[model samples]
Target: MSKKLRLSSLIVGDAQADRVVPPTGFTARLTLFAAGAMAFLTVFALALSLASGRLAARWGAELAQSSTLRISAPAEQVGAQTAAALAVLESTPGVASARALSAEEQRGLLAPWFGPDLPIDSLPIPQLVEIVETEEGYDVAGLRLRLQAEVPGAVLDDHTRWRRPLERAAARLRLLGLVSIGLIGAAIAAMITLAANAALAANSQVISVLRLIGAQDHYIASAFVRRFTLRALSGAFVGTAIGALAIFLMPSAQEDGGFLTGLGFEGAGWFSLLLIPIVAAVVAYFATGSAARRTLSELT
Candidate 1:
């Protein structure tokens, strides 16, 4: 006959071992509070990273597929050169559509820096036209050569020189946010380990009774793991909720021009935010279990 497995043969040894759980040992309640604070900060860091990534993708997509043509001939030849440039762009295979910006539109574009009325027409300003392209974009080298040969004083600015720097800055911000989350996670694990060791040291007498009664190593580890994991889960839950609320209460994109003001989770990104507490709890479980087993093994 096959041997039967006894689920009820409790490995905890002493049935009353539950009564020995101490209130103050390793991580004080203060440790949980600190962990919660760190988790909260991590939530914001994650949101910032995600938002910045989205912004970078949007900016890159917009700028990559667009180009600008500047017509800088004498006032008399301005119209002729602009027309010639438009004709060339229209004939170009990659170009989608070329548009010479209207005077009012030009004024609006400059209004942010120079105020509404800056004597736009009276000054000898170059004519500017916008070129929208297909997904493959256009051949800037070839187009510039064509413009130079056919339209004197014409220059093409695809905005690449300046756009690349903005993309890099956004990318760096994203990396910073990710690094912050990693550091926060590490801190949480360290705190849990310390807390478990403290609890084990404080309850030395309880551990002695449990071991004297034949408690398995797994049972001793479980006591510490269960307590620490529960604490971390609860703390992280409250922190995540508070962090999410704080982001929601902050000024939105419609209210602020500064990008920092609107930094937050958006759309389906909020769903991923829910995973933080679960991860914190899992980390605490493993950290506390390992610490307890190692410390107990020394005594054994």
Candidate 2:
């Protein structure tokens, strides 16, 4: 920005000869490679955060309007308690449907723990009824009170005891993923700064010669800044494209045991992912630019 530097940037040199402080060389390539690698990793992390966020929302929504009624009475009274609980649920304004599990269905559920051949009929297992609620959701407290009076052996479980904590844990995982992305960006900035500083240090003699020939700091800095910024921008785009493709190629929800498939973004989120290149470019611009200006100012 100094007048001395302005004169140097526009000072025409040899028309056919190569540039004095020519475009970045090996260092730029290495820096770009590093940046790209980091960006690619960050994209996956971002996808994980976004996917987790979606999963948490869905799980929270699905658990909100459902409850389970358990009848733990003696064998003689289980059927009566289950029927009474179902009757109460069906009569409630917010209740959509209430149905007691059939014997086969109950046995199938218990089979997971009792093995495939357990005699469920002989076990002192409680009978369970599934309750579905409408949009407003049922008043669980009131429903419990009603169940206690007419079906003393029935217990209402709104699924809140475990649902809320699961949701919070999912949400926290999403936040942690986002924080990881932020740290990656910060690391990129720091790496770029170091590379820029090294480039500046290496070109001290060239800078002095340019200044001696009526060149300014801006000209010298612009050359380095433009090269680094472009490299970062290009590398980031390539990385983002690769990263997005990787996420796109991930298995569907039904595949890969529900782990890798859930590690990417969906829908319009890809557009946001594309912005990472621009952000990387901007970071490079500021980092390289600031470092150049400060270093040059100290000399001339």
Candidate 3:
């Protein structure tokens, strides 16, 4: 109990021992640069993860509860089939709304491929009807049966093939982003550990003198731990702030950047990122303390 109290005091309460040890410029810069760089990369990784999640939710919400009906009958029958499909959809229990695409809308959809001048009336293009599902989506099998009976030429496109792949890709991207954050954290810990070890080796004489003066291992270790901890916190804070600003400066989602361009933090994500500096400081504290104690244990 007494040992733990003394150790705690040495780590956070006392400062004389820290002043006794001269700071090494090289290790100081190394720690600052490493922590800053790692924090910057971590911010991006976090953004990627958050953005991917948003994309997945958006795609699922937009595509999951809707279906398309295509009527490819002869030109004479197209109008009748489209009307029949819309009527069936309107009468369907789980369908919220259904509308047949206008001539202008269909032409606009085809203009991308066939050029603006392509005559819509001349082409025997299939008529398209968009169907929106209610809170309880339509039963696919039942809808298929109704369509087959009422409109032989109408085909349902549930968008399942398209949606599944996009959702899976977004999920994978999110997973990759999380893995990247973990790697950045591990890299930061490793570099800080190496820096701490180097500082310990450089201050061997100081350690010897302090030990001879009746200092405990925790007291000796605290000096290095506190220095690295503060350095990491300061560096990480600056890095995170800079990163956040960079993200803020990015083109807005309204710019039509699709998936990758929309990468950035949302409401609560910003709050979570604020914890990076604290996490870096904690990691540095433990890493430096462990290195210090291990190095001190090997001394004569």
Candidate 4:
């Protein structure tokens, strides 16, 4: 539309209107600082959201496909119950594989709590069996019933208690990260709006002179919108770059390092960071435009 083209031209460069707003001032610095700081925070928030999502998926998939069986019996019956549990699991439909952990493996599991030198044999440690499930996963209730009848000491743990809580925690963390990003965006908009209002108020004398010279309100407002939007875009770009660099320089994720060690983008995830500046620009466009128009109307 003709109106759209005219507006775009004004934003692109209206030499006459560009002079209306001072090129550098306190408002300019405020808009730049707010956008930059918020964009930096937005990057971290996005990283946290992505990391939490991956963590949730991993916990859901890994835990759902696996479970544990603990056998607590008199020293004489421990081996018998463990063997019986393993046999039951092997015969169960939908079981992919099952194995009774060796004494050494069990010692490794307990080493963190009891120390490596602690003699595992001296303790009445319950035998543990690891079970992996097929895509159609074994029926937990049925499996429990079978273990009860054949292996009296066997207790089946489908990891339901552990999995549900972990998944819920990861999901809630992801939600919180997303909410943080939204709040950051709103904060940026608020800051830009305030800066725009301040800039407009400071230039009322110039605006009055321009109005006397027949400058349309839309043309005057467009100059302020374009300037503030560009400032936001540039500031956000710088902030995003710095934040991403900081993330990249962080220690690489190691399998042993756990979730906290991997709080950064992975592969395609880096591309998502590029949107931060663009989003900031759009937020500024609307915010500054609204503030400019309102301030201009009040001035008249």
User: Over 4 Å off in model 1, which ranges?
Assistant: 1-28, 74-77, 102-124
Clashes of each: 3, 1, 0, 0
Residue clash pairs of candidate 4: none
- Pairs that clash in candidate 1: 26-198, 26-199, 27-195
At residue 33, what lDDT does model 1 achieve?
A: 87
What value does the lDDT take at residue 200 in candidate 2? 85
TM-score of each: 0.80, 0.77, 0.80, 0.79
RMSD of each: 4.9, 5.1, 3.5, 3.7
Quality of model 1 by C-alpha lDDT: 0.82
lDDT for each residue of candidate 3 in 195-245, tens digit (9 for 90 to 100): 989888888999999999898887788888888988999899989999999
Q: What is the C-alpha lDDT of each candidate?
A: 0.82, 0.81, 0.88, 0.88
- lDDT string for model 1 (1-300, tens) is 111121122222334433456666436576678668877998998998998898788779988888899889888998888899899999998999999988888888889999987999987888899999998888889998999899988889999997899899999989999999999999999888887887889888888888898987677766666667778888888899999998888877764356786598889989877888888987887798789879889876
lDDT of 2 by residue, 1-300 (tens): 774453344233222222576556789789879778887987988888888888788777888778888899999988878878888888998999989888899889988888888888898899999988899998888888888899999888898987889799889989999899889888888889899999889988888888899876666777777667777888988888899898888766764345456777778888888888888887887888899999999996
The alpha-carbon lDDT assigned to residue 19 of candidate 3 equals 90
In model 3, the worst 10-residue window by lDDT is 6-15
Span of ten consecutive residues with least summed lDDT in model 1: 1-10
